[model samples]
Target: MQESVFCMVVSRTRLIQAIACFLSLYKTMDNFKVYILCVDEKCYEFLKKINFDKIVLVTISELNREDLLAIKASRKLNQYCWTLKPGFIKYILTLEESIKRVTYIDSDLFFYQNPNVIFENQPYDSVLLSSGEVFLPMYSKEVNNTIQSLTGNFNSGFISFKKDIDGLSCVNWWDKMCVDSCTSNPEDNKFGDQKYLDDMPFLFNNVYEITTQGVNIGHWNSSKYKFTVLNDTIMVNNNKLIFYHFSGFRIISKYDIRQVHEQDRVNTPFIYQIYRRALEKIINDVEKIDPDFKGYFTVDAVDDN
Candidate 1:
């Protein structure tokens, strides 16, 4: 009956992220347990004060051999690896052996409000996939065709899985996909792990699609939803925004765009404002905590934008 959110990020982003997660949790401290699955032991010390049990440290090598083999077998040139994603999935599946249901979250996300309502109202299932079905162009035509051939849809990033049979089926399918991605069709920089989940619904029962913006309101190129702030609450297309995906996050670069040309397009002023605000808040908090926080940006090369 407890709600959970999981995030994976490097140690450098820990300070900025700690502030964001804490700000989001301040309002729902009693309702949700915020878990940051860290790969660095040093980062755990920085997160120690937030909530001990809430912050879990996991080495990246924690992803076992079978999973590693599956990903390596599916590797492509310069493509964002899908194998890393399966590693997280493996971690999530283990939770099923311990708990009922949990929400899997990326570290580069911000929650403007509590999201326990999603778990409270939505029926429990083996897995949850966020359908950008109505949200974007589905990106790659070839990938879409491949997914349709498999009788599934494309999604990653934000997912909810029930700890029962359906979730296991999804995990098993992902295990296979890591080795046999349908879009490994010799097309360079095409579909990576993003669309491979399209096959899960056809393979598993109780596999549901969550259409709410509250869960995954990605602020990247997909602008199916708009952001609005009212009375101090951030709303996505009229619904109060629960979480926002800072999808293009990286350490020094600040934004990480993988394999998409249009992603390099300058972020709209509105979107820039959103990130600037979040980053500003993070800087302020970091300075208050550590005056000598040597976290300011210093670029070796500059973006023309």
Candidate 2:
């Protein structure tokens, strides 16, 4: 049997992103399942209705952790998802034995090529992370590189690990770190849950960075690479565009999408429109199930403050 590979993601306000992420994976990839830890009961109930066979929905009640329960008091609303990542992976591993590997990808990820590019090429007993670089245009060199230099050179958008002694140990260590001090503040070598990933190479054996160029393209590195979509094939620097992390994509309205990719300067890729359309389609479909369903993007909140 093919190795039971899985992908885990968290969705609170960005329910459409998580839905779009799984839809893209199910449509593009051949193997594996995507597990979602809906950050609230509402998100969970909505996902349950869609009932995608390959997608499994998890909730906080299932996790049964006092640690996660305490997060609400200390962490802000947005930081909650980042904090749940490591613990979510640990939860899946414990629930299922056949899952030999798990790749935690951001809910905003949309794919055009097989994710197998990472797993098929992975050597025995190795942990995998994608490099947060390709080549940067001169315009992006200063700020982008400065942050990369400080926060480690890898993007935690997509992380993969094989089931083994070392892999579990690494995930556990990361879980502990996030629970204790995961923050957006990059102080004392901390910047969200991401900076901790900087140590993966020095801390573990057979840790490999992805050679797949199109795996995690976003604004930070997108400025450096050329993206061309020919007859439905999106290529990045002469390789198949595996996945594009639509990190800061915003729905200004149903017809408009604001592409704010991190703090990087980018000549927006055509993939943005394609991804936006997909999310729009999901929102429409989901709203049909429950007309009252409102996404963070769809709702317009007045700034009363």
Q: Pick the candidate with the highest lDDT.
A: 2
- TM-scores, all candidates, are 0.68, 0.90
Q: Tell me how far candidate 1 lies from the true structure as C-alpha RMSD in angstroms.
A: 5.8
TM-score, prediction 2 = 0.90
C-alpha local distance difference test of each model: 0.54, 0.74
Error of 2 at 220 (Å): 0.6
Question: Clash number for model 2?
Answer: 0
Candidate 1 structure quality by residue, lDDT tens digits, 98-167: 5556566655556767766666566665677875443235457676455444433544656666667777
Q: Which ten residues in a row have the lowest lDDT in candidate 1?
A: 296-305
